[model samples]
Target chain A: MELTGAEIVCESLLKEGADVVFGLPGGAVLPLYGALSVYPAIRHILVRHEQAAAMAADGYSRATGKVGVCIATSGPGATNMVTGIAAAQMDSVAVVAITGQVPRPAIGSDAFQETDVTGVTLPITKHNMLVMDVKDVAQAIHDAFHIARTGRPGPVLVDIPRDVLLGDKTEFVWPSEPKLPGYKIPTVAPEAQVAAAADLINQAERPIIMSGHGVLISHAYGLMTDLAEKAQIPVITTLLGISAIPSSHELNLGMSGMHGMAYANLAIDEADLIIGLGMRFDDRVTGRISAFAPNAKFIHVDIDASEVDKNIKATVGMVGDLKAVLGQLLPKVEANVHIDWLQHINELKAQHPSHLVRESDELLPQYVLQRLTEVTQGRGIVVTGVGMHQMWAAQHCRFTEPNTFITSGGLGTMGFEVPAALGAQVGRPDVTVWSIAGDGGFQMTMCDIATAVEAHADVKFAILNNNSLGLVHQLQELFFDKEYIASQYTANPDFVKIAEAYGIRGIRVTRKDQVLDAVQQAMETAGPVIVDFMVKEDEGLYPFIPSGQSVKEMLEEPTLKEIT
Target chain B: MVQSNHTEQHTLIALVEDKPGVLTRVASMFRRRGFNIASLAVGNSEQPGLSRMTFVVNGDDHTVSQVAKQLDKLIDVIEVSDITNKSTVTRELALIKVKTNQMTRGEIIQIVNLFRANIIDVGSESMVIEITGEEDKINALHNLLSSFGVIEMLRTGLVAMVRGQTNGLANGHSEQVNSSSNS
Candidate 1:
């Protein structure tokens, strides 16, 4: 039977088991939005801005390990979504962005609401196509989902013209699978590389595993644990790889790199053999490329071959899916012990522990995050914005589940928490979703509170309101000689009131004693709620390593300022 | 991502979907990665719905491998092969138009004839010579005609195929490096 391009889109979405789409409707996408009513299986959640749609989809994809979908019109809508799309591309999240273009006749005519969106997004997207014919709509959507959800997953764009969506010239033909000859998904690592990795793991005296976002993406947490446990090698997670292995795991050694766990960075620095799994050695994780893991021989395993030698050259670069590579390597890996290396790392951890929160009435951000971690007990899916609060959340809020701690890692995009939490809630309704963002980041996407209320997204938001943008403030203090400038904004709106205005319960906490009560209230009160913690201003993220410096230059305490 | 090493010229052939804007995708990749393309030749391939692209890349083996991997990652690209060190016969076609008066025209033709080139087009004051050979051979002919004041020159980037008893495009270098779902 013949169906409009819009119906084929809906049918294709259902075919891919896409239950929800985060999108904003515009002039070109009006027909597709209208067709959504006919397909009740796919729910459409309207976003306030086009950018939020992409971020929400990215958050949804990362949290649930499913291909997330977002839609927009041409021009500004597509351009606004670029940042979020680029974020997904950087972090390798699986997202399909369906953008509407001007009618075919009007294309390239400098038409109204028209943009060369495919061209604009070519560099940022894994793949993109402009569907000129109605008959190809299903193929485009199916192929887009396939490309986005496959190996080394990333965002893909499918631009459809307004006329194509409204057209009814061709019969609907839904191909069971994409016939993409070029798109490749690597599954297993070659035997030689796996054996090389095994030999390295077995022979090395000071071996460590650097778990990356790919670990969580491939669901290789079990295999990651097995590899580390069998060799008794310590595991250091990258920022995006926070939840790959539970923080409570004996072999798990917190996070690494700039603003990461001090011990983790030092351990990476001192290790002789580094097994990099499913993670790129991002610059943030490697302070200075020349000095990063100076003595370590790397065995890098990732789905993308380009990523293997992109940063630090690998001794044994095994290109394949992390799960399959780990599986192949794990069997060949013999049970061994690195007792002295673990003891040395233990000493390093002892020498460089997290700053202890003082027992006082002042409500510290650390105390708040500590209490929040206790409240969740690994049940909450925590999404965070970028800043000092993000660092605090990473250092304090421990995870026992994979995909539970979601944040904007590679792109480090601010304003990710508020909407991302809602998207995470939408994807996993049975679990409690929490947004742990700094006040600055919270304010950037505070408008999404309305979206949460409208969609009935059961999310708990904790605004670590420190007034000033703590990260920049600390940086300025260190480098720019403490000129606060625009970074410090003491005269800020009461965030609790803002949340209340959006029709959600809001609580303000100023005293240390009120931290527990505020957190408990936010988590226990159904629906959606917010708690604004008046965290200490000028709170520097500790164990800080200045940019372009190696792990040896990590400052265990705040420099340039005397402790109170 | 970029490394400076013993730089050498590498030729790559990519089999891609015969679709619109695909060339733009390939060109954009080279431009974005800051890889200088010495020459690029594209045309229809033997397979239906597929096109062939031949380009010369100047970089180390790492850079060539990176270029191949990145190109293979494109959705429209079926496969990419680096035939730099392969046993293959390669050729390029160059059309050189030299500003020739009656005095120098005869000498240019004789020089072209010696290089197995043909004088394809003759103008009132200029002559166009077509040469098909290795890049160096064409350059040699072009150099000899340069003193006669060459007006313009166009070179079709190198195109290559494996020698007898070999399939250059069906080699293991591309397959060994790429591990994908369908593999």
Candidate 2:
């Protein structure tokens, strides 16, 4: 039973049922790499960058609902994992990041390749540990997996010192249980609050359901859709909650908030009863807190109790797991609700649907997103980088199931899609993975294209190239009186050339007519492929109701008249 | 203003690396959890480099348990125990600054004398009284002195140790010794 500390780490991972680990080898982590060679059951993916390792693990965790594991060496190797860890934390992905550290004696002395990896990532992770002892290695790994997957799932870092990894240990014994005093998972729903919510829903004349990423995370999409259908309520999803319900459904009102459909925003404004599910009312969604649904009676249901009253007061607050709360409320709720409200919502939906100018020659971001959705038939996982392309994917992509469309919701981290797609592809090899990134965001971690090629993952990168930080540029044009600032990046590299350099297939589309062909070609490529769609810069995401403003005050449609 | 409402309470114990900034992270966590610590104590354990943090908090049992679980999840925290059931001892230290003029100086001194509190420092208009006991005992003394204008207060959060000699280091210490000898 005797094993080296490094061997204990690999053994503990196997015990936790990890079949694969995504990472790269370095000096500090040589011990782990040496130990990993003996275990043939667990596959170690060599990523091009440490950041991609973290993203791939995030994707794997989201797809499998298990703790995604990634490893890296000390210093820059550990620092590179920060973005991915922060993304996972923001999106509540279950990921365990293992990094190598300098020896214990040299920790504060700033030894070779020594960095305070734990302190650097403290704010970004749910929890982290620096293992200095050989005996604590197994327990630390076990505890890392346990903490990452339990309660509100998030990333946990386990930094093993180089000396400890090389140190000898008598036996590796994983902790039988994690004894955490302050980390209780709330399992019971308050009966009074549930009854009150049900009563309000039944009595309300104008009820609207607002869904968020929590609904998808809890896998309560079915219950949510059923509730909307049974109660005849119009459902409005946040950008992150796009795939929680099918867009084809009669009750689906597209997205809500700044760039939401005219009807969804207006409906929220007029609603007397608002059932907010698993969504923290971000500034994008609530224009102004004071004017946000002022007349509505709010019933907020979330697993995190802190989110309930943090922003936007709630008339009834139910704190527990989303699916469990909905499971209880569904039975007590009545079926076949009043038809008048549904008809009113349908009328609004028909009156003002999401429409864009369809010119035959002009390349548009909307056309690219729609074509990708068509080519994939909404069957594969779609990850997105933050910016104009993220909003486009959220608005245009037709998602049929939950957890299929993954993006950085809370943090809105740019350059998230490419590596995240690699992770998702590794997790679900049978399914196709599409990473939608803008020109600026795609450059952030496009080196991960090499990782995709190495892994031979079936991933397609749809780079919406506008040659600018599209979101920021749009904001500048609208709010800052056309002061472009640092939003524009001149002398942009040809993404196709860069993709070819990574040993991956590449294509470029300059016209709207070529979008479908480019997407189809990328989809059929055996390995990773990048399709750079040359979109026009300076196109604003429309129907934006400025933050802190009422939904009624939204720019309903793009106007020919210029703002004074 | 003290509310006349009954609140639930629980005991929490956390094993953390004896280092700087560890206490700050633990304190921030307590503040974030919205649980008021009744008593807190921190001291070096038999394990040369680790410290044991013990605190009693008031909240629903589930919330208290959650707080313990969360504290255990901290990177500096090696282990966590809710020694509410297990045999353990909990204590806290408090220093209260009291405002006393000619009218209430004697009364203030009388209350401090009764509680066996020591006067650590004295100002022109106020005297700082130091006391160490269970949180309830300090609360009782605080309640008694509130009638005579209280100026400031400093309370160390509760830290607890398990009964007898079953320390964290002791359990693993012998095993380490045996392995080293065998090698």
Candidate 3:
């Protein structure tokens, strides 16, 4: 019954069903690392950087639907996890981050490796606790997991002082239930609001369901698809909502946003009823709030009431679990196909087919992604870093399952794919996990190649190596009159050589013909492999809406020619 | 001044378990959401191990409700109600220090007596007067005392209650009140 705080932490984690923890050891966390040896069931992954630790835990959480645990020493270690924590918060991934603080007496003295991690992570975390006493350790851990995985899940931090971990001794008893009083999680929405939403769906001649990450969180993909098909509504997914329903589904209208498919954005504009489920109408999705879906009446469904009508006004707001709302709604909604609307959507898709330029010997990012998709048969989980490549993957890859197409959609954090893919691979060893990154972003956390080698993660990296920040370069070329500054990297590192140095197999392909073979080879490899596909530098996201412009002002390649 | 359509004062009453750092959680929520508190007061509630916090928040009607909703989501919070539009009794306590001379001391006492305020502390050259009233009344007294060259002033913000026998904490206004209370 008696245990140190460190032992209490391990026992609590075991009680919470955490089989693995991703973290790095530092000065303040020595006691934790010492105690970790005694508990063999909870495996600890030693990441190269604190950021990777957080990112890996985020990936694990997204892949497994459990609260991923990551730990770090205080000060710089805790600060390094800031980006990953924010990314998890933005994407609503459930992660419990633990940081070691200085001893209780030395907290205010600014002792070695001291930081106010609880204070620092307040805005980014759903909730956080600083355990000043050993008695509070188990309860705090229990509450951290409970808070992180509940309704509208997010990251939570528990800061344990070094002395608490090493000094204080107490009788440890795991509470049968977490003593969280104020945490009321909504399982079902109000019936009247659900009926009102159902009414709106039934009444609309052209309705569009804009699905977001909530579908995956609630595991309501079946219900969402049923609602979409039964109502004969087109489904436009947010960037994070990519795999809510399979991309190949008849009603699934691809991604909708700044870099979204032309037809999907057009459908959103033309729809009379917009049912926004579990996704915040972010600025990127709605170019100009005043002009966004001007003709549509919104029916917002989310677990968090605050998100409803925070951006665009919701005519009918259903605040609760997405699955419960859809369950209540499916019975009332009548099956009817909007034939005219479907015909119009087809016409728009025909007009703006995703540009697939396959000139001799030239490798386009889209071609690489499509080839990668073909090599994997779209069966693998693709974790993407941000940039033109991310959009390319979103547009080109076929995602058949929910939570398989994971990315940092809300925070748009680059360097995410590498560590995240490692975590994903660790969590789901049976599945093929691919980390797709641009050359610029791949370099940011390529240090985690060592982590992949150490963990023996069977993750494949599809580096769309354009040797520059392609998205920013395209922006500058389009808007800055070709005055490229920091966007272009004068000397990019040879990624294959770096990967090889890190003891992972590496291959480079400059020509389009080599993409398929390289991707296939990387997929066939026993361990982590990086395929550097040298893509064209000038390639830009087509049907792009300029900043501050309405969806109506979208510019394709021809429109760019006209403007120039 | 042309007022923004979104700007309005919202009075919120929250019942939270009296535990360490509950105040910090509530305060941090407001700070993180960037909602400036006009005034705030916290004290032990009628229920044991429970604290009631009254906050005057300045935000649009939508955002104020959002703050309340977010507060309810915190682990320690038990219940939150926007008592802004409710018929309620609100009171604020303040201690005002005014620089009073021989010429103005008698006049200050007369004005204090008129407002039913007490002179809590009298200094050699100044007087610290105490008053408890609605915010408007306290402001009025402060305005009158300012003419006598006010030195320092401290206000306890505002605390409120509904007019009738409706117990804000006991009713099904929140989850698990009776369950936790029984234990």
Candidate 4:
């Protein structure tokens, strides 16, 4: 039973059923790497950069609903994971990050490869610990995983010193459970509160249920659908909440917010009763707080009480697990219908249809996404980096299952698609995973193409090669009078050639006829493949709501009649 | 989100595990949320291996409640109570140094007697008076001593307890608010 700190780390991870970890080795973590070699069944994907390691773990967690694990050395290796950790925290993904630290004796001396990573990551993580004693390694890892996977799941860090890994010896005994008295999450809402919410839902004529990531997190999609169908109410999903209910379902209105569907925003504004389930009223979703859903009486239900009334005031706030609350509410909610309200929503959708991206000779991003929809048959998991391509994917791709549409909505982190797709593919090897990224974001983490090739992760990359930062350029065109300063990249590398250099198949398509064939080729290829679609540079996301503006002030592309 | 009339002061008491880096976690939570802490006092509590912290916050109700819930989310924090609206006996101790002259010496003593303060230390031209009372009383004493040309002052923030055995530390403001609204 006697084991070194390094052995305890691996043993505890194995005990928690973590079979895969994404990491890179360094001088400070050599002991851990040695211990890792003993466990041949545990897979470790060697990432090109520490940031990709953290992001890959995040993607794995989101895909599998298990705590994703990543490892790094101290100093630069640990600091480089900050962006990815912050992304996981923002998205509320369960990730446990383990970093090597300097020996306890030399910790404050600013020794080589020494950094206060616990202090540095405190604000970004849900919880973090610096383990100084050797006996605490197993318990620390146990506690870290428990905290990461529990209430309002987020990233947690455990920094272990080198001396503890190398010098100290202790019996590795896994505690029965975490001895955390302060860690508790309420599971049930009060009966009266649930009754009040049900009463409001039963009485209202026009009601809409706004779903966020919590729906997916709690695995309450079935209950959510039951409630929506039982009540005959419409559901508008947030950007991250894309697949909470099937898009094909008659009740599901598309994405809501800045780049969301115009009809969805209109429905929310027109609703008389708004039941906010597991979704925060982010500023992006609610354009102007005072004017957002001006007519709605809100009922907010979330596990996190702090989120209740943090953005918009709720008439009745029910704080508990979404699944449990919905369970208690499903019976109390009477089966009803709003035929007039549904007809009105249909009218709104008919009136403000999104402007289609026209195809001339060059490839349009939307056209490619539409083609992807056709090719995947709404069966593939689509991951996206932030920008025009993300919005385009949200608009075009058909997500039918929960956790199928993965993207960084809260942090809006760029360069997320490549690593996230790889992690998702690794987590769910049976499914087809695609990374839809813009040219700028593709270049940011394109170095990870080598990582994909090494792991033989079957992930397809569709780079919307617009040769410009399309979203930022569009912002400049709208606000700065088209003075593109730092937004545009003058010289760009050939992405197809870059992927081919990493022993991955690559293809480039320019004309309209070459789009579907190229996409089909990437899908049928054996290993990782990249299809660089030479898209138009000036295609702006239309029906835009400018920052700090109300939903009523959205600008839409004029049709020929309006133009005349 | 109810907007307050103005920036109102709130007193929050929290019981946390006596663990290393616990204070930093609490302080960092407040800083990240952009809620300013006017005063903070930390010491061992009645329970073993636990510390009690009382901090004064000035912000709208939305931000203050946010801080309280976020503090509750920390692993080291066992419970948090916003006793600003509750019936409690709150006390703060302060030491004020007043520059005493021939004409103001008697006047300062009379004022100190009125305030029921003690002369803790006496220098050649200055006397340090120590006082312990509610926040308003301390503020009043400080205001009166300032007329005698005060040199320095230090205050321990407000620490409070419920007047009776109502167990204010057992549950947070949310539970109390829920019960009060029902009645």
Best by DockQ: 1
lDDT of 4 at A210: 94
- RMSD to the hidden true structure, all candidates: 2.8, 7.8, 2.8, 3.5
Predicted candidate 3 versus true structure: per-residue lDDT over B1-183, tens digit per residue: 111377888889988889877888888888877778999999998877888999999988777867887888776888888988888999999999999889999999999999999998887899999999999999999998888898999999999998887855435443466554311
Query: In order of the candidates, what TM-score does chain B achieve?
Result: 0.90, 0.73, 0.91, 0.88
For candidate 4, list the clashing residue pairs, or say none: A313-B1
Q: Model 4, A1-564: lDDT tens per residue? A: 799999999999999989999999887877888899998768999999999999999989998999999999999999989999999999999999999998888989999999999999999999999999988898899989988987789999999988888786899899877866677777899999999999999999999999999999999899999999998999998888888898789998878788888788888888999999889999888887888899999999988888998888899998999999999999999999899999988888777766245445667788898888888888879999999999989877887779999898889999999999988889989888999999999998988988988988899998998888898999999999989888877789888888879888989988888988998998889889998998887878866778777789877655412211
In angstroms, give how far residue A352 of model 1 lies from its true place: 0.6
Model 2 / residue A176 / CA error / Å: 3.6
Q: Candidate 4: misplaced stretches above 4 Å? A: A355-361, A559-564, B101-103, B172-183
Of models 2 and 3, which has the larger TM-score?
3
Per-model TM-score of chain A alone?
A: 0.97, 0.95, 0.97, 0.98
Candidate 3 lDDT score at position A219? 92
- What lDDT would each prediction earn against the true structure? 0.87, 0.81, 0.87, 0.88
Can you give the lDDT of residue B69 in candidate 1?
84
The CAPRI classification for model 2 reads as: incorrect
Write model 4 residue lDDT over B25-139, tens digit each, in one string: 9999888777799999999977677788998999878788888988988988888888889998889999999999787888888888999999988777999999999999999
Candidate 1 ranges beyond 4 A from true positions? A355-361, A559-564, B2-4, B171-183
Q: Give candidate 4's error at residue A180 in angstroms.
A: 1.4
Interface RMSD of each: 4.3, 11.5, 5.8, 8.7
lDDT of 1 by residue, A110-179 (tens): 9989999999999999999999999999989988888898889999999999999997667888886676
CAPRI quality of model 4:
acceptable
